[model samples]
Target: MNGPHDMGGMHGMGPIPIEADESVFHSQWEAKVFAMSFATFCNYFPVDETRHASERMPPGDYLTSSYYERWLYALELLITEHNLVTPEEIEQRIAKLSQEEY
Candidate 1:
């Protein structure tokens, strides 16, 4: 739906810089996120749904989070909405990995 995420035909935002010969990915994790998102789509998650999920983020988040981070947030939303994983399970796993293991 129409939201702040829709920035098309807007003003105030600066012009986009076109880089000559931009790399497909600026880092390894970007590639991983790209692959993971594609695989998730292959499993039947509609591409439009994914876009809406990502775009529905708060305006601040939508503006500040990087491209892959936005994909991840959208993926999380879809996964939980579709019951692929519970929020608690996701949080538990995040906590486990976030802690020091050494």
Candidate 2:
């Protein structure tokens, strides 16, 4: 069984296998992060009234990337917008991580 902060188990679903290297997050925390990021991204672009209400629309090319990629992009945007992380620091961290093998 997982603790309060463990997100290994599927939400309202059966248990999900936990990989040895994956970082476990609190389900609530993940939900909050997702909501925040999704809302922020939605606000980034103007809505298209012409599009059908039920039809799903994709974000711009940049946001259409993978889930983690979109998260990283949103994080970068938030970091810069809030002045939490400097551009130089982001570049340095990216370079360092790129050199490391998974």
Candidate 3:
């Protein structure tokens, strides 16, 4: 039942910091996926045509943001759109994790 969208957080993987050029791909599908994932992580709706405007999230905000924060946000959008994970489950999991020590 789990998929890329189901992967709520990067956890121990740390930040997958993507650069502008490195982010772009020759294949349109790859580009779309990257854009979608990035936008989703940033808690922004994905837009196909206007990627520049869509991904124009604040700068320092990104630096301050955790990898898991970005991943969780994106997964939230993807799961909702694809009917993968329920909001109740998301909340429950988050609550459970919050009780644990880092």
For model 1, the run of ten residues with the poorest summed lDDT: 93-102
**Using Cα atoms with residue i matched to residue i, what is each candidate's TM-score against the true structure?**
0.82, 0.39, 0.34
lDDT of each: 0.85, 0.50, 0.52
Query: What is the Cα-based lDDT of residue 55 in candidate 1?
Result: 86
TM-score rank, highest first?
1, 2, 3
Tens digits of per-residue lDDT, candidate 2, 19-76, equal 7876544455466556765575476533332122112223353324444444545556
Q: Which of the predicted structures, 2 or 3, would earn the higher lDDT when compared with the native?
A: 3
For model 2, how many clashes?
0
Instruction: Output the worst ten-in-a-row residue range by lDDT, candidate 3.
Output: 48-57
Per-residue lDDT for 2-82 in model 1, tens only?
766787888998997777998888888789878988898779698889998898788888888878889888888888999
Best by TM-score: 1
Report the Cα lDDT for residue 20, model 1. 98
What is the Cα-based TM-score of model 1? 0.82
What is candidate 2's CA lDDT for residue 91? 97
* Tens-digit per-residue lDDT, 49-76, candidate 3: 2233222324444445544444444455
Q: Regarding lDDT, does 1 or 3 come out ahead?
A: 1
**TM-score winner, 2 or 3:** 2
